[model samples]
Target: MAPDQTNSADVLIAPAPGPGALRHRLEEAILGDIASGRLAPGTALPPSRTLADALGISRWVVTEAYGHLVGKGVLEARTGSATRVAAVAPVAVPDGAARRVAPAPRLERAPDRATHDLAPGVPDLRHVPRDAWLRAAREALAGATNQDLGAQPPAGHPAARAAVATHLRRSRIVSGPDDAVVLTRGAADGMSRIAAALATAGHTHLLVEDPSWAALRDAAAAAGLTPVPVPVDDAGISPGRLRAEAARTGARAALLTPAHQFPLGAALPDERRAALLDWAREVDGLLIEDDYDAEFRYDRRPVPALQGLDPDRVLLLGSTSKTLAPAFGIGWMVVPQRWRAPVLDVSVRRGPAPGPATLDQLTLARFVGDGAYARYLRAARARYARRRAALLTALERELPGARIGGIAAGMHVTVDLAGVRVGPAGAGGDDAAVVDGRDGVDAAAADFAALDAAAVVREGAARDVALVDLRRYQAAPSARSTVLVVGYGNLADARLPAAIRGLRAAVEAASAEAAGAGAGAARAGPTGAAAGSVG
Candidate 1:
């Protein structure tokens, strides 16, 4: 409280007890008196010194309480005037007495949340640097002028664009901050803009990786372009296959997550990266590089963005979604000089553009500029590395025979079933029994190898493990059998073992069913063998 401030009444009475400090209690008591009409409107509160004397409390406490009441309009104080209650007083809503209304009928229901969340594409949210973000926000707020609160450009904040450009230069080696980078909501938002820009540039067909991120495919379709699926292997998007697909479909635009392929987690090798850029140049095509989580590479040196090699043909898209948090919704697009005007024009006029508030952009700029972003990345990278190690260890010990790839980086690793087929149910006891080494079955042996991925997913879900079918990521099925994409980010290090165990049980059940069917067929003899020999 300020030195000049004081309560006015000659005598004061304390009220019933409540939570918080003495000052808060006094404020609540005074408000209660006014609410109950014990202290009427225009009733003067006691002088701070006098009230402190009467109540055996500090004068400063009384002074502070009165000041708080004055600020709330519960009490009015002015220079050389008595502090009195306002014409009206606020009534506290009693607990458990708030009016209840019937909940509206559900329209669209949310899916059941999994206990062990192994779903892909999400990072470990537990390690978000809240303190650093808050500090950056405060700094941005302190430095901001009145103009910063005003209407922002459709391309986003100038400072933010510059910050992002600086970041890309250091990380991806992309060009200037000047009219090169456009702010967006995230990678999805950037892709949507790129899709529209491609359409505007008269490109009808876009080449996309088989087993690509679903959002990229959806964005292309939403922009009225045909997404031709080009197969991706362990080397990332296959150069030969992508070229063939582009040639066959006459696709002039290709969207790729080259640094770290989604779901599969393959970092596009340098040779393939060069091939992609060459194909783009030869076809006069556009490459939209979604560099979502490139910073989280656990093994090998960082692969710079493909856009850095051919900025004219490649459009780089990046976001805080994977790095900082998805809720931030701040992203950027590094576009070719020729495409900038059209992209900006579409961004301003068309929909799904940058919705991140001006303040957030400023905060993000401050965060990146002050090196808080880099520090946060370093911390997150280490944490994820440990988690990934734990996941790999558990998978090796429990699942054994599963061929895991995409483990060198990213949050998920692809667990390939290595040509194992799900046998029919009649010949087996249960897949779990087989996988547990019951009935003289070796879990790593050939019989346990070819279990149904779909059944594993279903059984895993039943066992409280959220399993995503790897085929969902595939554009078309290849020779590899029953690949399961296990996302280790969401699951805690402790829960990983249990989740893997549940998954093992599911696979085992599948194997047992296959074995049971095989045994039943064998018992049915030469007739059964003749019947099974089809085509």
Candidate 2:
């Protein structure tokens, strides 16, 4: 029943109370009503006389019950108005069922105790233009109608899709509206939809970049699709390797980060991009292009999206998480004609892809159409460029000879620790962890790098410097080593130097510990064994 139509009198029941238990029965009934949402906040209760006549109970019994509930804070009575359910009354929710949904931002924030945050993918929220956003929001709210708040069609709001279409065409060289654009909660959510659609079409395997973002692999798995890791190189995902993997695994779709590869930050070269598209075309497969963080290109002009190259064979997934703020659950996918029906089917059943609030979608529509988004991007690009510069400078000054790459774009930089020694001397051996059964890197060497990175991370944590080791981004346990993914987006210029300085000190301490262990092993080598009882 509609909330407005649920009559308070209709919900009440006549009770057969025994031995002075009338008040207890009435209280239980009212509590159940509130718990089940029958007695909604601000909903007026029935007049004492009316309820007494219906229930055939004493009016004072009803009034006493009401008065008792008011005392318990379950109901409230104003001087001239009827008693109503208290706005803050606690509901007796089922176990494990939340009465309220807690909000979690797509971006991560440093813990309160942390002094510095170098974690990657976190945006500097200070960059959000509050005045512009508020203006857009107010405009959207003022223009909304009662019908706008009603059940919307499955595809999405028309204004939002149209706005997204215009934005894509102008910024990414992609075009389409209404039917072409499929709204999602975020990039991961888009991947799940695509994966589900592909699975429904009888394709169960997806090719994802090795050492890629874990979310891509996880989303595919959640959609009942197996993720096969295809190794990546400086140019981007190795097209040759990907083709071979697809052939072996019968994967009909490949998820890629062509514009700016996550954690690795390599723009797919023109030739590789062409090769990838050719592979997709030949196999009659699909490419899920995660166009995340492509707008903040620092070294050169942004690369055109892979979906723009061949929209029919590529599904472009882009989100406002990086460009605007992660809190706004707004993202879009440019779907091909062939997959539109199935894609829309799954998305609609999910009930509002990304399930964005109506006001958010409208505000985003206005923000994009009015050029406020572009202006914000331009200003943010400048700010991130400066932060990236500061981080690089700090790294160079504090830890010379460390190799940092993938800095041309994206919010994070990759620090290669191949040359750094992090374990005891004796721990160095010939074996290395091979990524994708390809690169025969020394396992011990990678361990040493991981140890070094861990020590630095621990010291940073103790000192309130929040940083992460690069290994965390790898999908498989042995997929990567010898690197630290340093995100500079969350740190300020003044704090970069100090954080880097602490990181260097931690590294030195770890080196000393390793060296001392090696020396102790050397001292114990001869004495620990009985001098040749040649057994």
The TM-score between candidate 2 and the true structure equals 0.72
- Give lDDT per model, in order: 0.73, 0.73
RMSD over all Cα atoms, model 2: 17.5
lDDT of 2 by residue, 1-535 (tens): 2224445544443342223377667766677666666567767788787676545356898899899889878888899777778878765543212211222442454434244678888776545666688899999889988877787656667888888888888888885555698777788888888899999999989999987889878999999999999888887899889988988999979999998998788888999999999998998989999998988898787888888889889889989988877878788889998989998889777865345676788888889889999898887788789878888887766565568888478789888654543222212234322211222333323332233566567766877778788767676655435577888776655456677776666665555554445445444445554434344
- Tens-digit lDDT string for candidate 1 (402-465): 6787847767888875432222332233432333233434332434334567777888888888
Question: What does the lDDT read for residue 340 in candidate 1?
Answer: 91
Summed over model 1, clashes come to 18
Model 2 worst lDDT run, 10 consecutive residues:
94-103
Off by over 4 Å in 2: 1-113, 352-354, 420-451, 526-535
| C-alpha lDDT of residue 141 in model 2 | 88
